[model samples]
Target: MAPNNQTLGNNELGAWRIFSLFMLLIQKGPLPSAEIYAAIYSDLSTDSALRTFSRDRTVLKQLGFAITEVKTGKEKSFYLSDSNFFNSSYDLSPEDANQLLVICSAILTDATFVYQEELRNALSKIVGNFYSLESGKSDSQKLSASSQNKVFPVLYESLSSKQLVNITYTNSQDLVKQKHLGVLDFFVSQRLLYFVAQDFSSGTESASIKTFRVDRVLDAAILKNESFSIPEEFDSKDYKLLDFQLGLQADTLTAFVPKNILAAFEHFSQGQGDVELLSNGALWTVTYAHEDTALSWILAHGLIPRSPESLLAKWKGSLSEVANGC
Candidate 1:
């Protein structure tokens, strides 16, 4: 077994599977599922391996990895950075590179959903070391300060102290609204920094959490008069993904899953969707903001998709591309 997959458990709940997948995808090129399964789950059969791989892929999606499918007629092959985004030289431009820098800065300070602060710090320095070959040390300093979101430090302090905050936020529609939030998770996705919080100022029951884009925040002031704490019963991880789907202009997607893989599919789509029992098989409806993401997952898993003409067209387009390539 590879060193990466050795210690991770054999089940879907083993989060290390995600790191394992990363290690696999970061290798010498696009790899088919058969090879990936062989490398990560050498002891398990293909059916058994897909169960865990599906869950790991779900985690990757949550973390904003754009896993692309490159294939011929034989099998689907996954290539992590199709746009060469991973190999691009370090720059100060306010684009994807800048977004990565912003994320690195936040992970170095805030409590995270997956990686630890120390781990993230190590990754930042490692990437910095790589970038040093081209640029100098001063560029690295610029990298840290490049997180131009002015409200970031206050949000970090708010989470650290369990303090409440009043934020004037602009939604996707560009309508600005005021919210008093208990800052929970501050992280980045698809090149934007977002935070999940309990909205104390909402008119609804306020039982559910909400995600907000930090850059969209017009102003943020920590409410010194109020403090908040998460109850022992509340699990932020469970709600974070679903709220993120809602936070974006996410669309609903329904698909059919074979009985053989239904359990794994259900587990994989956790936090963002649900399953319906049917006489024939099972149906899964997922809320996602990115079309490429949905297409990649569907291709990677070999699931039968039913809705959202855009996705189906893209899925067919993927197959047609492969066919044309052959």
Candidate 2:
């Protein structure tokens, strides 16, 4: 057992040594093989180290490191061709570093931001390396756990591992229910976190794919043994909470938006619409699922539907009913 443990330790060290060699070559490159072996393995005989390095070169190439070799006379020089490895050489100027420090300071001090502690810690580490930045001070007005939704990390893990989870969810109507979900993807919109997932339990009258507000989740338990895969056709980009519909089919909505609401609409649509600025407002054409939620948004915003006679007639009927009730 002792010998086996020692072997395992040696294997781990060997792997790290190989990675270090890659990083060294990436930082200071086009070096001859003799020089690389001398820098990394001074303890080994020159001939033996050269042979081992030559074999490791093939291993690095197979791992997609983009190692390039250039021949000069009887010697071969090697370097990493990936631009990302060389980005560290481009150091930020003092002015740029100061600007980053200011921005990070502002964000770190703001308690309203989501993941505020995590963001502040990350920024502190980065800024600390360049300039002396003060540690984050505790705020008296820190957000409560309920408002922060502590379930974010659990949902993130479920989504990453493709695991199924049992969730106690509070619906829009304030009804509480339990559900088994195969986590798919997550996104934030309108300062709210939402998950796009597949319902695995029975009595799902709607589409199998649906979205759930993370904040409304009262409890979640990950099912480690139960794993699921997302459908090949499902794309998270096609679905958005702002669109007000979860259905896969969509129809083009043409309307004139007021100048005040144009920016809000653009934020929700994520620049997925065609807009032409007019003297009074903007003429916009965007795609949305033909659902009650979509119709309600158009009515709420007092938008005039420019196409689809059925939709126009429905909108008129809705207004008539509202006026009659009043």
Candidate 3:
């Protein structure tokens, strides 16, 4: 229904359309077809847009991306109920068996199950944090050791009380050492447990924030009566610090993708950025966390950089290096 010519390839335009549909649902949450039609199919007449929407929806359903339509008083609205992104299968480790033992010890130590309320309230928080919900065939997270298990409860306590702690941590090289830290928070990413803390072992004046995987901690002792303050400007958001999002400089990049190869770019964009579908190609605008990140995407997708001379130079240099290698 929408215009598709050799000027811009079908894949690019098609992918953008699909990605836009998904993002439309994400940004606005529940959206009725009328709103979607206006946003995506405004160029088409009502009849044409309806036909196009039906075809796209059918294809998406076939792909197993469940976009559910709920009946809302004579009108239907779409909603994305869930995603399997974090519902991953993890195999239980020996450390998990170790945790099972610790759990049993805890429950047995508690004499009065009375209402089971107090026991439930206490163990729930610690167990839920690192529980292997279901053991599966995949070996995603193997255990380093359960020694960190001893330290975690102390870390959790300090985090709640704003108390400082002294800990001995073992690195990948097996080098073990002790340091004082102020635990800020704990988070799970990709099924592993990690805590963010400020290292103040040297002194409160030279404290530095860092993320430590829970399993690496060898020992912990809560420093009672000792506490620390987080820096006022410390924003939790700026610290997701996932590898791709971390870089030396942040730049909003402009990329021109050929008509045919647009799908790849669209897929990468996930409709989180701006896109201008032109007769010849698609102009995509997004911010890259670093020059290397920009170069990686552009080189992989064969995109032409239209702005940011620095990125263009880096692209050229990469191409030159590749040519020399060949």
Top-TM-score candidate index: 1
lDDT of each: 0.61, 0.62, 0.62
TM-score ranking from best candidate downward? 1, 2, 3
Identify the superior model by lDDT, candidate 1 or candidate 3.
3
Best-to-worst ranking by lDDT: 3, 2, 1
Poorest 10 consecutive residues by lDDT, candidate 3: 107-116
Global fold similarity of model 3 (TM-score): 0.39
lDDT digits (tens) for residues 1-326 of candidate 1: 32323342343225344555675676546888778877677767778787867767665655556577777578988768756434324333325444444444433333423344334444434433223222322443222332323355566556756788888776768687888888777544444445778888864544457777665565677999688877567775555463225445557788888888777876656545677888777887878776677777777776777888888888778888999995
Query: TM-scores of the models, in the given order?
Result: 0.45, 0.41, 0.39
> What clash pairs does model 2 have?
none
Model 1 scores worst on lDDT over the 10 consecutive residues at 128-137
Q: Residue pairs in steric clash, candidate 1? A: none
Q: Please give me the total number of clashing residue pairs in predicted model 1.
A: 0
